[model samples]
Target: MTVMNADEIRKLLPHRWPFLLLDRVIELKPGVSGVGIKNVTISEPFFEGHFPTESIMPGVLIVEALAQMTAVVYCTGALQAMREAEQEVAATAEAQLEPAEEIDISSRVGYLVAIRDMKFMKPVVPGDQLLLKVKIGRSVGILSKVNVAAYVGKVCVVEGTLSVSQRP
Candidate 1:
């Protein structure tokens, strides 16, 4: 298992700023699975308007963090497959210096298809460090299902099923 700091995470996911829910990737097994962390703070942008005096991290953001972690797994798997495909092509066929200019229409193969059976078990408050675990559940052609969970220490804060499709 390899750990990815925030910088590496930024390279993998397109999210930025207060929208980037993942603070760091705690563990990553490349194409197989990954886990990430999100630190809740009073200074978080949402808390100000959500409740000035007594604020809590929104349940939706917790879910988003879990989703982003899941997406990392998806991107990793797809990139690995893409690299393998390229290697196989290079090995068997004559290599060309010219790259495909069409933006590789196959890149849109991955997209989120569904978010199901989501449950919020507890409130995630300021100063809480959320640990998110996401794993590849099943794959049917270009579609894949990922099971995800978020925890505050030993307590489960949220859990759900995330379905992703490689077909545009």
Candidate 2:
């Protein structure tokens, strides 16, 4: 089990503020599954245009959040596998990467190529804490499908399946 804070997430993801939807990754199992948190607040920039009075969080953004969470799981798993392979090569070779050299995971990209059966069950509002969960379903080469769901206080706000393709 690997838990990633915002900083660690930043090191792995290229998304920045306003677009970086995930606040924290509570539980992660690399490519298998992960659970992430996104604390919605009135201060969110999107709320300004999404709805002035209602302050409803957009459904598309929610899906984007879920996708970002999925990326974390997918990328971390890939990073771990590469690291393990590096260790194996080091065992046979006397020279390896310098002490300061490390993998630059932020360059990785995951594209959301498809969204299926997505339903926005409830309108998300400010002050709500979203619980984002994703599990890898199937994969063919660099393309992978994921089961995604989002909840707020145990109420399912969104659920769907997303197909993502990775880019080097």
- Root mean square deviation (Cα) for candidate 1: 3.1
Each prediction's TM-score versus the true structure: 0.84, 0.93
**Which portions of model 1 show Cα errors greater than 4 Å?**
94-110
Screening candidate 2 with a backbone cut-off below 3 angstroms (N, C-alpha, C), the clashing residue pairs are: none
lDDT of model 2 at residue 166? 87
Candidate 1 weakest lDDT stretch, 10 residues? 100-109
Estimate the overall C-alpha local distance difference test score of candidate 2: 0.91
Q: How many clashes (backbone atoms < 3 Å, residues ≥3 apart in a chain or on different chains) does model 2 have?
A: 0
lDDT of each: 0.81, 0.91
What residue pairs clash in candidate 1, if any at all?
109-166
Question: Ten residues in a row with the worst lDDT in model 2?
Answer: 94-103
